[model samples]
Target: MSKQFASAGDMAEKQTSFTEIGDGLWAFTAEGDPNSGVIIGDDSVMVVEAQATPRLARKVIDCVRGVTDKPITHLALTHYHAVRVLGASAYGAPQIIMSEPARAMVAERGKEDWESEFDRFPRLFQGHEEIPGLTWPTTTFKGRMSVYLGRRRVDIMQLGRAHTAGDAVIYVPDANAMFTGDIVEDRSACYCGDGHFHDWPATLERVRRFDLDAIAPGRGGALQGAEAVNRALDSTADFLRSTYRPAARVALRGGSLKEAWDAVRAECDPKFADYAIYEHCLPFNVARAYDEALDIDTPRIWTAARDKAMWDALQGG
Candidate 1:
């Protein structure tokens, strides 16, 4: 049979874990699915990345309630992907935050993304019917902004573009911990469908300079301590380079997208074959890397039709 499209064939539910990486901060992670971060401040809480649907988000809510009852005052999204933002309603947080550019992407392609992602992985959208609509940020900033939950100061900053043109990282200074949405994944494949391949490494470097003690990454297990944090950072950078270099070589040589796909697989599979979502992410990552090699600065929007076309083409590669 033809390879399943995206993650459509992978229906096994991931085992979820809620880890306390800092004083009051938690990382709500699944085996390899998307992750949500929790920051329990003095008087309230700030949640990072809303998950794929209200039902999935409720799982996060249940985890939060197990620890504290602080009202979720702010919902911060790292980027505009449906898997990250469509579940906004569940939070009931008064203030929703995103970078200005991220908000713009939501306007430009939110609906299309919602459809494409839902089509790609039906399992993630457990309660698709409950998703009211595209998620929008109530509060937006250009580069940096700070939100204080009573006494704790959480710095939400857009360091540079990596996973998306408008990715943001949430840093809690008092704990020296950060919530890096898809910008840094712990042994999970970085989804590059809307990514900036050429700019990703530099952005990772900027995140590294922070010298974080712990990180609630976009996916996979939580990273605690300087050594573990640094390793994930380095591995993420390596994954990007391994994916882009071979694809770029093929594109520069006037090769086809399928050729680029094979090139990337040959280069990346040996190293990252065991990583979470590696197969699900390969085609999209190769496509973007091929485009970037040709100097395509902006990632093209992905629609359901385009997703199918790309997957079919790569399947025969």
Candidate 2:
């Protein structure tokens, strides 16, 4: 299998798909693109992971309106990703929430991430000019926060570091469902550019502790049933291990960055070739994994110039 890349034109014309995961809960997906989750409580609504821009977020708003007329009261960011949180302003929710660590990451490297991601995937950043700026959390919690939507309860918890140091998940015990940000991608490749690989598996263990019947992963279709949920979790773990182990091996051998990337690509591309965004994510994933294996604690910031330089160096100019 060969990895398929989405051109900017293809993303521009793509249509988002919204599917009901549970009663009053919807998953807004777009052909393995960025995903958003919606939870409609008795009195109001809570949107999880705003899209890339306000214009894009409006499409999700329209989907929620199709089912309920309740006002959006909160916007929840699963992590500090430009493609995921930049569209938060469109929600107009009084409360925008995130983990404390996530807020810190936004404050530290948010600007560089915005420029890096926009350059990497221009299609997702349509109407990039409409963005007010980096999405800041008006409300932040350290460990966990539980909010009631009338009778419905949504628990947002920072399980551990996975996709990023500030990764979080939204768990609904009533529905036995969990909305895992990028912590666990179903059919899509996990973007581990800023990830903590060693901590990721442990984070997955925390996520599995919940008796979840279904999962709204950050990308791809929602996982339904115990079998499918297990499969998603297993696949995500496998992806991390396969990519990190090989990259780690190459780095330990004192190989060049190109050699490490080739090692990861040889190992992962063969197995995850059919997964969405496999090619787009590999370079960054290998770079971070290489750094981590060499005892680099914090991932380096990815500016637009750095992104092009890395891509050209690895994939050829």
Best by lDDT: 1
Backbone clash tally for model 2?
0
Instruction: Give me the runs in candidate 1 sitting further than 4 Å from their true place.
Output: none
Best model per TM-score: 1
Tens digit per residue, CA lDDT, model 2, 1-317: 12222333355466678888888888998878889999999999999999999988999999999999998998889999999999998988559999999999999999999988887787888798899899999999989999888999999999999999998899888888889999999889999989999999999988887868889999989888888898989999999999999999989998878888878888887789899887778888998999999999888888988877776677551
Q: Model 1, range 10-42, lDDT digits (tens) per residue?
A: 889989999999999999999989999999998
lDDT of 1 at 297: 93
User: Per-residue lDDT for 122 in model 2?
Assistant: 79
Candidate 1, residue 124: the lDDT equals 94
Candidates' C-alpha lDDT: 0.92, 0.88
Give the poorly placed runs of model 2, Cα more than 4 Å off.
1-12
Clashing pairs in 2: none
